[model samples]
Target: MILFPNAKINLGLDILRRRPDGYHDIETVMIPVPWCDVLEIVPAKGSETTLTVSGRRVDCPPEKNLVMKAYRALAETVELPPVDIFLRKIIPDGAGLGGGSADAAFTLRGLNELFALGLSDSRLAEIAAGLGADCPFFIYNRPMLCTGIGTEFTPAEVSLSGLTIVIVKPPTSVPTAEAYRHTTPSIPQTPIAGIISRPISEWRGRLKNDFEPSVFPAYPSVSEIKEKMEGLGAVYTSMSGSGSSVYGLFDNDILADCLTETFAGSAVFSSKL
Candidate 1:
């Protein structure tokens, strides 16, 4: 079966505190976006499952690829034949866009359906949590208010229905671990959901990503992207996650095309939300 795993952007990310497990406690809103990667899985002629990727090169070895990990993770619980897995990447990684996690989550869903193994989304999301914190969000693929290192989820009422989204990923990639090391976790007085409920124009200073303070100083290009978007009259602008990818929401379509053209060499995507 074939599946297209889409990307997601963090509407607002707050690092609440450091946990006992060394993972930080976080609260964020994740909004699904249409930017996607292509994955296909089919019964294999050989005895072992395999993975091959095209388009944007994955930085890790195949054995370490999340796609293969997802297959193995599922195989551990159920009977399965070997399969040939193919992935075509369109979404850029390390953009805090949840591309890899989305791929892994979609793999589990695809496998379950392809093999006729009945599993509810809740069950799948439960399984996905073992893969990555944000992996579970893709199982439902909708607006979600996430907490607990980004694994726990509750449906979010927020919507970008009438807006246009423009995303730009600069040439560099941020190391998530490094970003965390440099960050200081603190709870916001006003919750992210509350800020989101306000007018989009009011989101400027209230809705924030805790990672931006450290990320922007280190990666000015990413910072520049946010600045440019604001200068271009974006009603709301923020770096999606830790670093390297920034998104802006606009009320009209005019600047979406212009932003795409402005950042030609980067991985730029524009779509109506």
Candidate 2:
């Protein structure tokens, strides 16, 4: 089985409070981006399990990869043979791009169908949440109004089909824990669903990412990318997730190439998923 798992950008993020469990309580609108990772799984021929990865800048030990974790999770319940899993990485790791979570979600989804596990969407979501907060998002793969550790999600109607998105990743690694340490609970709130329903033009200034303040000061380069995107006439610009990646939305492609050329140190390009 082969599947493509896409990355997501947070349109608006609000950290409501810190929870007793160590994770923060958050509310955000997550939208899918065309940027994705590919996963291929085939039945194992021998007793030993095997996994491989390929693509630009792919990092991570094969045994530690999320795909293998997902495979093992299913294997525990069913007496299955070894499986060969291959991951083609495109999204940058630790950039808040949900690369690992996406791969795990795709594995669960693909394996369920491939092995005829007969797991319902809700059941698969249960497994996904065990892996990570972002894992559940890929199970539905659509715009969502997410809250409470990103597991409690409600579907939202929003599309970026006609918009051009410029994704920029500056050279920085943001630890999720550190990002939360600097996060302030007094985050501005907005009608996220309403804002998403409106035209992209209307989203120019009304929406905001709560993580921006906490992350920008820690990583000045990330802040610079956000400012540059705004300067390029993006209708909306914000940092996704905990930190380390920023994206801008423009109405057309005229400024796309220009921005990429200017931001050479940080990888920049226009994409849609």
Candidate 3:
């Protein structure tokens, strides 16, 4: 089975509060982007499972990789054939792009199809929630208003139909743990879903990510990229999630290309909405 696991950007994020389960409550609108990673799985000759990776390096053991973890998790419930998983990573890690979670979700969906598991979307989502909060979102792979540690989701009516998106990831990686530690959870003046319903032009001052205050100070380069995107005539620009990756929504393709050219050393991706 071959699948392309795409990346996502947070339209607006608000950390509501800390929960009793040690997970924080959050409200955000997550939208899929064209940037993706290629994943392939084939039945292994032997009983042992294996994983090999190429493209952008993943600095972790194969066993710890989400693709392998997804296979093991499914194997515990249903009989699964041993498979050799190959991942060609393109999305930048620790950029709040949910690349790893997308990989895991796609793996679950791919395995269900590959083995004829016949698992429904809800069932697959239940299993995906165990992998990560953002994993369930990819099962639907549509714009959604996510809450409750990002597991609970409601389909959103938002669209960026004619817009062009430009994403830039700096060399720095922001640790998720550090991001949470530096942030202070609070209620937003306006709900993210509600804000997204308004005109994109209004998003400039109203829509915001709660993590930016804490994250921007630690990494000025990330903030600079956001500023530059705005200066280049982006309709809206914000840090996607915790930190490191910033995206700009432009009115035209020319502006998108201009912005990409401005950032030579960083990883840049431009595509239509």
- lDDT (Cα, tens digit) per residue for candidate 1, span 1-273: 889999999999999999999999999999999999999999997988989999998889999998888888888878889999999999999899999999999999999999999989998888888888889999999999999989889999998998988889998999999999999999899999999999888999999999999999999889989988888779999998886799999998855467667776788898888
Q: In model 1, where do residues sit more than 4 Å from their true spots?
A: 255-257
Where is model 2 more than 4 Å wrong at Cα? 57-59, 187-189
lDDT of 2: 0.81
Residue 87, candidate 2: Cα error in Å is 1.0
Model 2 agreement with the true structure over 1-273: per-residue lDDT tens digits: 888988888988878888898888888888888887888889877778798888856566887777787777767766667788888888888878788888998898998898888888887788888888998898887888998888998988777787788888877879988888887885555567767778877886777777777788778999988888888888888888886889888886745558757688775657643
Return the clash pairs for model 3, or none. Answer: none
Cα TM-score per model: 0.97, 0.93, 0.97
Q: Candidate 2: lDDT of 40?
A: 89
- Model 1 score (lDDT): 0.91
- RMSD, model 2, all Cα superposed? 1.9
lDDT of 3 by residue, 60-92 (tens): 999999888888888988999899888999999
